[model samples]
Target: MTHIRKAVFPVAGLGTRFLPATKSVPKELLPLVDRPLIQYAVDEARAAGIEEFIFVSAPGKTALEDYFCAHAALERQLADKGKTDLIERLAPTRMPEAALTIIRQDMPRGLGHAVSLARRLVGDEPFAVLLPDDVIRAPKAALAQMVQAHARTGGHMVATMQVPRAQVSAYGILDCDEDAARGRLLRARGLVEKPRPECAPSTQAVIGRYILMPDIFDRLERQGPGAGGEIQLTDAINADVETVGVTGYAFDGERFDCGSIQGFVEATLAFALDRPELAAGLRARIDRLAGNDRFAA
Candidate 1:
């Protein structure tokens, strides 16, 4: 089987949910604790052995491109100040010269359309697609787990997580059966894009992570508008179920939908609480706030 070396990040969304904050800054550049949202997704891709990074972005997202570039002036300032620790912290933000590619998605058609724009960069190899909105915290990165599962099963794979039955309409629902050999892997029979709760096939909803064969571009090209009158990636993947086959890997992780204000704040608190330096103080503040009558419902 071909190795999955390339990964695509679709960052073209307008991020209207974030209002004034996203008006000037791309949503992917929003800070989660210290690192930007896109950084976490990139880190996860690196953990999965993804060598090439392709970002499908829109016109106003130049900041996203600059974030991964080397800041020589800042580096020199840090060196002059003898801030070696801070310099070391900046290392991961620098991307290798030839490993990064940014493509323009001229229209805000949909996720499928954004991904389709990366075809030339991805070429004929299998690739991974990660949406920065879904920040997943796990001992083992979700994409890494999917990469391992893909190596065993090939075809196409998606990250699956169980959500409340009532919330299935918010995500791409999977119609699948358990893989007998691999308990955590599910053989997807079909995919439903944002189906109503009454019509949902299962509670296992597809998250942002995906491992797809290059042939998916063809299906996407022929695909018309689906749910929400946009080209839904779920619909394209569904079209391949009978032939190429899709697998669902139930990843062990805590996922935060950072696209919304509530999820973003929740993720910020969760990540801050994970840091040893901030944990004790944050815990005390949280405890104090909990007991304050001003915060009473």
Candidate 2:
């Protein structure tokens, strides 16, 4: 069994939805509370024992790369100022010099194409891919749970969540057979991207986390443009349903879709409230706002 030592982060998306703010700063760098979105994803991956980090980035994403880079001058300044707490806070952001790899994806193809670009670095090992847009808050890191599941069953594994029937079309719906023995585990028979609600096979939807085998590289390479003339990763995974086999694990977590404005605001408040320092102030504000009928509407 290949331990999931490496993790891939697809950060090449332009984040057109955020527009002006993302135009200058990579959306992954946008702060949820104080830490950037990408930082949270990296922290989660680290908790799962992922040793190497690979980022699929685009031209304007230099800020994302720099965020992980060492800032020696700033560190020295903090030390001189006796700001030990600040230094410790920044410690988690540092990575060993050789542990990070960034691959540039010039064209805004699709998730499949972006993932395929990492083939040279990922090589033959089964690796994990995390989309930073989905910020999941859970007792145990979501990827860690999936990694544990992969240890039991050696095929590809993806994190799934039960979405409302009406919202099924917004995600990659999993067509699965329930594992009688393991309640949360599902044997993925197929995957459909943004299918009509009536056409959805199951309410279980594929989220941003994926632990996939190396064979998926070949599948994505051979898969032509799908849906919106862009290669879809779901299409590649679906193609290998019979051969490679895919499994879905319904993760225990609250997933916030940071890709949308509403979700972003909600996630900010959720994460802020999670911190011991911010909970009281935020909760009081929430109470005050709830009292205002105009705000309620």
Summarize candidate 1's per-residue lDDT along 235-296 as a digit string, tens digits.
Answer: 99999998999999899899999999999999999999999999999999989999999986
Report the lDDT of model 2 for residue 97. Answer: 75
Candidate 2 regions exceeding 4 Å error are 179-181
Which segments of model 1 are wrong by more than 4 Å? Answer: 178-181
Q: Can you list the residue pairs that collide in candidate 2?
A: none
Give candidate 1's error at residue 66 in angstroms: 0.8
Which whole-number lDDT from 0 to 100 does residue 232 have in model 1? 85
Q: What is the lDDT of residue 121 in candidate 2?
A: 91
**What local distance difference test score does each model get?**
0.92, 0.91
